[model samples]
Target chain A: MSDTQTTVEPVRMGRKATQPLLIVNDLVKTFGNGVKAVDGVSFTISPGETVGLVGESGCGKSTTAKLLLRTLDPDSGEVKFGGQDLLGMRGRALRRLRSRFQIVPQNPQTSLNPRLPVRSSIEFNLRAHGVPKPERVERIAEVLEQVGLPGAYGDRFPHELSGGQLQRAAIARAISTRPELVICDEAVSALDKSIQAQILNLLAEFQKELGMAYLFISHDLSVVEHISDQVLVMYLGRIVEDGTGSQLWNRPGHPYTEALLSAAPGAERERIVLVGDPPSPANPPSGCTFHTRCPIAIEACSTKRPLLKPTAGGSHAACIRTTDLQQP
Target chain B: MTVEAQAELVIDAAGETSDAVLSVRDLTTTFTAGGQRIEALRGIDLDLYPGRVSVLLGESGSGKSVTARSILRLYGASAIIGGSAVFEGRDLVGLNEKEMQPIRGSGIALVPQDPTGSLDPVRRVGAQIVEVLRLHGVVDSKKEAQARAEELLGLVGLPDPVRAARSFPHEMSGGMKQRVAIAIAICCNPTLLIADEPTTALDVTVQAQILDLFVELTSSIGSAMLMITHDVGVAKDLADHVSVMYAGRIVEQGATSTVLDDPVHPYTKALLAAVPTPDVPRGNLIPIIGQPPVSGMTLPGCSFAPRCPVAQSSCTELVPELVSVELGHSVACPVATEFGAA
Candidate 1:
């Protein structure tokens, strides 16, 4: 009863696990012209918990993944993995930390080397981390099998495989390292519908068997709802809503969150389609960053940036006029 | 000549067929691979009215794209088309390439899946549009073509028509490139437009905008659109009528709202359930539970029977013809009567 009633997880990141696998706090990243690609984004994943980061394109969900993996440096914030603050770490420390967290990019076509055989590409990862020669071949085949690819695929190049098979190999290579957390950045976006279901099933089963956590980031609300435990909704580099998957899907708090959830393609829901593009983060809206597109926007929404406040439904929303939004 | 090859143009000499722009009848296509004949489309019948949007929905190998290619006669020597795909009153099956060339763009145009792969990466996007306009004899002079190209770029909602006219395909994003392709397809101003999964490569926000662009283009040009896609939600968003395809055949055809709100065919029902939606309460979306059969594989009974829940033994013994369920609703299944009724 409590788990269903509360949107936040009843168990908060399993305080007893062998240190948090990954932690991000007050993370901010800005591209050229001071466009904040990621702003004040924070979350945590325990040993085996999966947190879904959901948003539309340009909401900076992918940037959050890149920041945690250090593929892109954060302007200001903290990323602590395995109890070590990663922002200050450099050289071998950073490289050593990277080995503990792996990323699987969205498009396998672009990610995998089309010219190289998939087996060699997968084996390259393990060998770089000093995996023994004899063990690498067997482990490569085992991981490939784990992601539902046949063991015989070790001899085939990326071009020989279908889109589904190519994506499976991408997952196999990411897990070949046996990292503590797998950062799947829209991993299934490019796959077909039937193939998407198979891959999602593989990821779920892998998590249960290996006890690994996932920092899963995707724009697809339906996909996140099917697989995620805790769901965080972002807009313009900032988290505007965070709760359990069912809670966010049903009673979304922020207006931007409402627009995104209702706009999910597969199922019919009451939707408020916004008109304008998200204001550029370089010179974002004065108060609430979403005030430009907020349907029931108020005067205060233009002057004051509201802090993330707890609603009665146990979800958090960064909207000062959330309660009054319903009033005429 | 055989009746198949000798059939005359049935419509009046004025190139009219009542309200319909294209009327396909008993169209079947086959292919030969590795010394074996492969039946891709057994038989498909469809009608397209002027200025109406229709979706040809199906999974991979369902003959959705095959039907599109057959319409254009682009399937190469591997194909052997049967029956007739009539357009503008002529049976397209036996037409020579020289005869088909003039009819290709002036009568109908096709927009492919990935614009990046469709367009020449080395060439300028504007030049490509200009080539299509000139090839179709819509514009003769280069200056007039350039002027029309700028107008088209603006029509598709590109920010600056002048700059976009000079841009290469690589300079544009996936969404922008798709817009350029849409612009080119509409440049010829064909009576009908065939788009095959045009938004598959784009993001969700960009997808909505592109769908919006299609609606805008259709209404402004008043061209009937045959949108072939696997996304049923998109069918709901854009299609005026819908036909659900399976194993290269349409199992269900009806007005979009009636079919989506109350589908008669078992395959149609299963397809509706398979697509994941946000508003449907937390439960498993029971997909069709299997992939489409391969193109060359021969199916004895109903193509969807293996995955259908209420399949009977009789369903595997004979192929069922599409019987009318109600006005404007028809399904190719014996059990179709059980749907939308007590």
Candidate 2:
């Protein structure tokens, strides 16, 4: 299914917008120290659909992003992008596929080059994809305008801009190539609330116009639920729950999801304060990793590992007592 | 005795000295850098009662950190402080370093913003706690200090206190490092605790646990807390009283439910509207246009006038003063005050 074209279009072409843009099956990554960071993770994203990956620190959300981005070589997995095998591609074939996928990292200050102008940074991506120099300048201008940044901002260095402006520049650079999928790995986590809202709105607006699917990864559940069409809860290197935003928000099936919702500030429901820290990834529990801190955990939870089973809430949860724990 | 007697006269002159553990009046902080004077904290008034949590809520560059640092006298020589921080019948602003040494940890403890930055990377976690105990004379013998350190570690909810005590800062997680920081801060059990976004670095679940720990430890010791955060939800969950700051000034201050539920100031209302809650549907999130004014920028009138939605012509002419709408509730917006009066 791999298509290598010498002339790359600025927009996604030929694929039906409703079809799956990216698909992953049984992705697994174990580090040097025997820590299974991303263990048997599998999900799919359609064109223009946002899938939020929410989890605590060291819960493999970031590692999953890295694996999908092909920055880290996974131990075992299959990643298909635009009906092409992303894992098997190498050399120029992989490089050509890269223009169809992009990333906006967490810190724009570090992601953006300090020495170069903002326009040049965006131009670098287009140039790498073999775009002509004249076309690169025009595309940079178009993206900067789309992101609501002033045209003069293109000539300014990153240090001259504020955090919000730098993030805008980062977004401009990411969309300059008109990638079908953009992985925002905690993109808005560093900014203040108001700035965060502005960036979120911008991303949503661009997705509407460009029809780009987003893999929005963040530890902030509220932000995730706000922007995501589907949300996945990860814990101890495994996906514990997967459902629609409203489904996960209203009737969280997994104990870990319930605890996360309860722990969020201003949650109307009674707070369920989980005890102790998450176990080390390298030394994760045998049966169920989250059973140690699950509020309604039983003897079976410690003895038998639970698979992703459909719960009463219409969401898939990896828990033995999801039905019993769901509130009316 | 003379300082106490002088403090009595000052307190009476300040009027209506309630049972506040820390009473701040007209607290202003200025920094001089590159021959430029920048006002970090404009004139402010606050009253923190024992066993209650008062949160200073604002966006970045709104002077929340400056307020906490000014109280602790943590700034360098460039900072020109003008205010009164009265704690335990003594003014802290005028006290010299030698005089402030005993009061810093034993009288009022500080939980800094970053636990990783505050903790000693090279030393064991237990040694750091024990050093604080010894420095403040909390315990006499080294062995006793070590035991107390372990006890404090357990109090902060470290699962294996002995193992955690022996572990280095690098050996622990972000949550564990923060717990160690909290353990050291409460080692002396001061009357006032200043925590600057203590849970901002941790995960949401871990943040919930740490916030609960703060409440439990402070109330048990009857210590008033001044928490600084940019999150309105955090203030809502933890604060008994909340102060909404904008452009180096307190635009509103009231009980948490009162201010957050029925915010009068346009800036406070805008900030709340900007937050992305779980209930708020996608595409409904309101983005406050324009950036917060850079710190130290000289604005003639209301600093937030340019961004405030309800700002009128007069808002740019005169700086709004805090008007008491009701008991323990105040707002600095003229339009909001007028509406309340009507």
Candidate 3:
């Protein structure tokens, strides 16, 4: 683990010296039905940094990504990308900003158009960004090759390609615009394990070559752990813990984070099986939302909500008992 | 006896005779779609021993699900299935729908992948389980069936069994619906349970709970389980025996620890290596090159030879048989079997 950490040291050190690429401050989004999908989440992503956002179903991880991209307008928050207020931008302004940001969704099968060939799908993004038609073909071919697909594959439809091939094409489309940031919302989750590794490795290689920041969102912790520099653990529309991959994986501060880390297969940590499913976002438990399922929930947990405070592990954890719990 | 000792005792009891609740040998299934015969499963050999879990591990289109479906004779008229699936001295392969009726739920039950899809959306979750119980004749009275359904709901760790029983499949969350599906599958106390990627659609925490429920229920009932999944972690966590499938054939079969920890077949090794594990450092995965061959695509020799890292000339000339490398461990690569020993 240390050797792996050392290998990624240069990437971390290079990014730390530079100003952050994107800064999300107190972002909040509540649906029409009174479901607070994202609540008061704040994080920063540096240039070429891969931030892994992990949570279970309805944990607001996807909602946060949507809010960042302004796909769904945030109820209230500040999203500053490249030092510009992204939330303030509208219409043509927002569309202009879109060239700098792109998203690769979970299912490549649905994300890609069945009617269009793989080349057109990638070219569509380039076309939208006002790239000349002459350059689109070359860019598409270059991206396809970068993602490990043959240039000839550009002629095939989505149905003609396998799940892995389709995902690579989806990635090719996402990166074709040469966006500064790419929000991959479980982009590799739908693919097979073998293909998942291929995609993960390709993403890592792309990050090194192009120096693009990634908002890698997924439910799979191992995938997150492998790719991310900083990992955020969300529970019930709130950031329960924010730390590095090693910090979250090796020494998770929040009980929810701890339970999640343990739940991941092949985790050597002692299993802390959280009882029951996550409470509905519309009807989250009072005080500490996780108290209902927290293994170490004290009386204070139900009476008072915990604030995200700095812990010994150089991570912020929103758990009242963070100091009391023994470090892993 | 203590819990650990008791668990060991049960394992020993099951291991003594190595009593396979279902023994599938040389099972093949071919589907004729669009005037083309596609081999979905080719010579799949697996055995599910009582009180233990045997996992059919593979990616989509690898015939893991087909194997489960074939065991129950669930395929329609167009499917041409061959070979034997001996359950209780009866071959399930040749059985017609009418013949398989009794065996489907009573002898073997399926907890399908998509819980919502498998469940009756119109019916109440409780009523569905009760219907299965009544249809299988597991319970005589409606009152008894209702009571049993509630008990099963509780057994699956569903909160408020009464409310859960009254709610429809659409009303329940994905995890709850899956639990209901599991409850329905186990209501009859079948000797063998076939869960096809049961937790694939679930969240990690929910998946852990469901898997824990499966282990607890199956152990207590002394039921053999055939757990099909593409996830290596799930197979590692749950399976006693693991069968790695590629292009509709078993490439490797052995104890979970043996196959996962030290795989022989290049495909198996590549599959394990490809998975992103917490222990493994970032950016270190060596992904298997090339996609699995599409169904109906003819391969001259080994199906995995095109993508196999250590393939030689001979690997492309002949499809190797599953040769024993160690006790209870077999690999389908002649090169690996011969060289992997060192």
Candidate 4:
């Protein structure tokens, strides 16, 4: 927040034709003298893509989101958006970038101001981007219609609506300014499955309509699978695996990824059960972060850090034993 | 006289069946808020057979817990429960707190959600177990209570029972704390155990372990169980019988597989479709478009028609009661015969 310091990146802007709509490479962030909150994480999302970022608590998925948004300061690496270095933006430059990106944060009940009515909440986003008040009502109405709520519901307070309805109002607020990239942070985790389905469907529909991208963050794999075009699996402040939703869920490469999929309630995993809790991120293992809990862990996996490598297709996993990880 | 005897013989049609442990007939509870009456239950008819797991599945605010608390007489004297909830041929609905005290924790018990929260934070878990035993008059001696507590811990698959018995709730994991709650629920060897969202707070692997323990313990003791949960998957996997509740009433009831696999009521079908099943691949999911009616919400006909896709004009005008469709299946919907179940 200081005026003098700025978010500067070391890497040069890559090619323009296929620049990642959002690029987060080797993003390292730490808390007050704490361990790496986001350790060596990398992912890229193009236009109209929905990338699901999933993991259990303390997996640094939330940390990665903050880094991408530039709300939190990263110790190293770069966050690039639109073939432009996002890490160098300062003050007005950063504020302008924020207009292109918005976040519908977790827990709509607490996210939306209780004192403010739904109408005012929608108007705030438009006003922030200097949209005239005369046109606010029209833009708000369009977003509300997209989420399947009538315009009349706009004047009511968030408390007046049900949990499902309140979330729809939150979604309307996020996209009212038509941001190119939106961050849905556990947007539907608090909602019932039926309500979750509606929100996920609405997100997909909006992506096709607006050609926007999303950084979908959640611990629930079901929601991740339903909405995300590609998926990123994080554990202990690191991205364990990254690939298409099918390859990640149906055929995971990392030991941690397999454990996560198997841990799903009704997944019917092939009798593979993760025994111990994941190691603490603050005091992570020396080499492979997941070796402590890996079931088929090799001796090499414990002492030597493994670089993320391609496995079979447009998928990559960070593990030493490729043969063991590829086992059926 | 001979004709009267023959009629009585046919009236007792269900012969060779075991006597019901807890029978509820026409049970209903209403509340008066702001000078308006809110009917929480409308003539709930149910039976808890010995050693059977009867699941009451419903979404939030569906009166599932009200049914459980009503039998325990926990609604206070002002609740005005109608009809009878017969426990061992005794009308539990009419019993006062003093009269019901001896039965609770002795012949009936409850395993609530958040096992750690269920126990007193300041007291040691071992002492809490002993307190339950003393309350039920199962063991007057402290040594006897402690011994029984250790045994119960072992029964629920806890490791190092002696150490766990002395440990506090904070020292244990979520699964271990739930096991401690189970240990307390079965300490008195009650005839029935009521578990209300016992596994909701735990992870998947831990949930499975706790559920399996419920089956193992209830069967071993021949104690009937009443499990109230929002998850339909667990109901399918665990319950022998399932009762689907919506808008403070049982809309459907039958064998678990039959009810879940071929649900009749539109509400039941919608509720089942809501859960994201892993067996079913990722695709477009069918979600009920609208919210369930809040308490005291009423329409001209069916409660679920507001969100039901197949709702007809007639469905909005006339309320329907449970209609028998087969030997065990029953549904409360006018369009039950027409709706093609999933």
Interface RMSD of 2: 1.2
TM-scores, chain A, per candidate: 0.92, 0.94, 0.94, 0.92
Give me the runs in candidate 3 sitting further than 4 Å from their true place. A1-17, B1-18
Among all candidates shown, the one with the greatest lDDT: 2
User: A6-39 in candidate 3: lDDT tens per residue?
Assistant: 1222345344546677888788889999998988
Best by DockQ: 2
**Clashing residue pairs in candidate 2 (N, C-alpha, C atoms within 3 angstroms):** none
Relative to the true structure, candidate 4 reaches a TM of 0.87
- For residues B1-342, could you state the per-residue lDDT of candidate 3 as single tens digits? 222233334346543333567767789999998999898888987777778998899988899988988888888787999988878767887777888999988899999999989998899999999999999888889999999999999988888999999999988889899999988888888999999999989999988888888889878999999999998888888888899999889999888999999999999888888878666766778898888888888687899989988899998899889887877788899988887774
lDDT of candidate 1? 0.79
Cα deviation of B3, candidate 2, in Å: 27
Judge the docking of candidate 2 as incorrect, acceptable, medium or high.
medium
- Candidate with the larger lDDT of 1 and 3: 3
TM-score preference between candidates 1 and 3, better one? 3
lDDT of each: 0.79, 0.87, 0.85, 0.78
Predictions ranked by DockQ, top down?
A: 2, 3, 4, 1
For each candidate, report what fraction of the true interface contacts it reproduces.
0.14, 0.74, 0.73, 0.24
Q: After superposition, how far is residue A215 of candidate 3 from its true place, in Å?
A: 0.5
Q: For residues A1-328, could you state the per-residue lDDT of candidate 1 as single tens digits? A: 1122233233333346654567787899999878888878877777777888888777899888877877789989888888899888988878877767888889888888888899999988888777899999889989988987778887898878877788889999999988878989999877656667667777877887776788788888788877777788888888888776777666777787777755544346664666545666777888788888888898888998777777645577788876754311
Sort by lDDT, top down from the best: 2, 3, 1, 4
